[model samples]
Target: LPPTGPVRPDSYDFSFDSYFSGIGGSGFFLGDPKLLAPASTAPTGAPFGARIASAVENAREGIADHIRSSIGGSEGEIAAALIVGVRAGIPEAINESMRRTGIYHIISISGLHMALVAGTIMFLLRGAFALFPDFSSRRPVKKYAAAIALASIAAYLVISGIVVAAERSFIMLAVMLVAVLFDRAALTMRNLAISAIAVILVSPHEVVGPSFQMSFAATAALVGAYAGFADYRAGKTTAPPVKRSFLKFLSRKLAVGVGGAAVTSLIAGSATLLFAIWHFQRVSPLSLLANLAVMPIVSLIVMPFAVLSALAMPFGFDGPFLYVMGKGLTAMIAISAWISDRSPVDAVGLISIQSVLLATIALVIA
Candidate 1:
């Protein structure tokens, strides 16, 4: 190996590496310019990891272009993933879509996207399985579908390499899977406890990393928020949806996405401040608004192509879909770049690690 600081291979928590690559990519692509100096654009050509990332990204680009063309096509889930999974090569129209919305880039796949993908697939598979009465009526297909969902999620985790989210999602899913496989009803807290214990035992240091802390925290908060929303939507009075006009409807969506982006940025931003103060010296509150506008498109448009592309390539019939997906994903990327290039985002400056960590702890507790 080339002479350098002792190799601190963070392999113990590969999940961190996955998440770092994701947010780090976003930081490089859309983050404030002052954050990255000469090294920001350093070409990691020919390195093993770079090669792998490139191959995957190249596939993502193909899938994205395909999705863009075949608006309604086979493997639309994968098409969707490409935009969310890899935002590096998005084009124009998708970008415009986001600019109109006003949130963050939707490239980073999280619990929301995962749940959607899983839910979509489960429904699809369930419908398919139902066609065959024997399979449909035999045993609870939900368990088998859940296992398939777990497998699909694993594929996503590896492909996206989203560290913290992948790890935690995998663990939680695994717990659920065990219960399903054994035909036992699961207790959520008990499963969660097992996952937590497994995570620490596997990599104690992950407790200090942004991926570990932030992923868990965000998952918990979102889950809580979603539960509240579900209950409220069922009957209780809650925050009313913005009144809908054609133009106003669009604005409300953008506002909703921006709101989500703000929450995400605050969580992810705090993690960054704790782990790498030198890299991020200030925080930009407006980033949430920007993110909110853009993120929905990224999730709905850009990232889903990874799986979609893979699904389409087999019969050599994927080219057209790939082209469309690529175009849309590329459009999404181009918009983010355009926005970054023009009225680029600015930061609020960095905080001390201790302060960041303390804030993180507080957020988690709350």
Candidate 2:
């Protein structure tokens, strides 16, 4: 999709979740989590209405478990993002940036994060298992690796709670893990396609939502593109150049943070902007720079700590880590709030959900 390229053009993943606050009328949009429970506080929990919350939580746990167990890799970074946890305030330049951006928050836990995580964990775990003799054992290390990932994924589901994009990613990854266990060949495109089918069958109404359609559309595009690119690159001439040292590579990672933040904003914010374009009433240009400026710190330092601390808490030895994570998260909140207060954030609605879906279909067809 011409409109969806900034985040990871080839993949159906772009979730710039600017906020996770229950405010901004989120319940009105997130559709259904396929589970339900009554609304009681604390230990009382949900009452007779088990149809809403309980089912959703159970579904999330099951999906998370399956996914983590399927990974022969490290998707920790992506898994950390499943919650759509962070919520930054709007920049001050355009005062209405708040209401619009808030109103525009889409499902953040989408397929791209899952793909990145699965691929990352797979590559890392495989490499680690390769180098370390301890892990290269007669035992079912691959299976265990997948299991651990699944456990982590389940924790992720409970911690993050909000389900949309992440759920789809979780489901697909789980299926692939099953395939791995069955000794079947697994390809990304095929896996993604199958996942799409499964998601639709289970939740027919998902077809009517922007999160479901957009998430898959973006992911499919990326998978197809990357596969084609990989083949193309393999056949290209002029292979080698002056090799850079580790420091150079590290620099790229750091730089990638800025680029990634901007890209996230572009992918998410731009789509929303399209709807407001006709009236010249919506625009989110500042979101990119604003996100770029802080997201690196969030991704590299803050998010990791927050995720780690949260994970550690269940073990009853998390205070220290929790403190660290809390501080980092706090810093992010403060920074985002300050920036929004200072900047001239402007935005315009660009397209309707219908148009977005049509464009996504056009993208799929192309």
My TM-score estimates for the predictions, one after another, are 0.57, 0.58
Query: Residue-wise lDDT of candidate 2 within 1-366, one digit each (tens)?
Result: 112222423222222222222223222346655647643332345475655566655554543443233221222222223333322222333224323333222215444445444444555566677777665775666765666666555555444564655676677777777677666655587887788799887766666445665456545555565577678978989657667899998898778866655555565554434333422344554566556554555455544554454455457564564445445544544555565565555643344546655765565576
Evaluate all candidate structures by whole-model CA lDDT and list the values in order. 0.55, 0.51
For candidate 1, what's the RMSD?
10.5
Residue 261, candidate 2: Cα error in Å is 6.5
Please count the clashing residue pairs in each candidate, in the order shown.
Answer: 66, 51
TM-score for predicted model 2 compared with the true structure: 0.58
Evaluate model 1: give its TM-score. Answer: 0.57
Q: How well is each residue in 23-123 modelled by candidate 1, as lDDT tens digits?
A: 33222256555744443222665678777676666655555565545654323433444333545434445444343333322434655556555655666
How far does residue 208 in candidate 2 sit from its true spot (Å)?
1.1
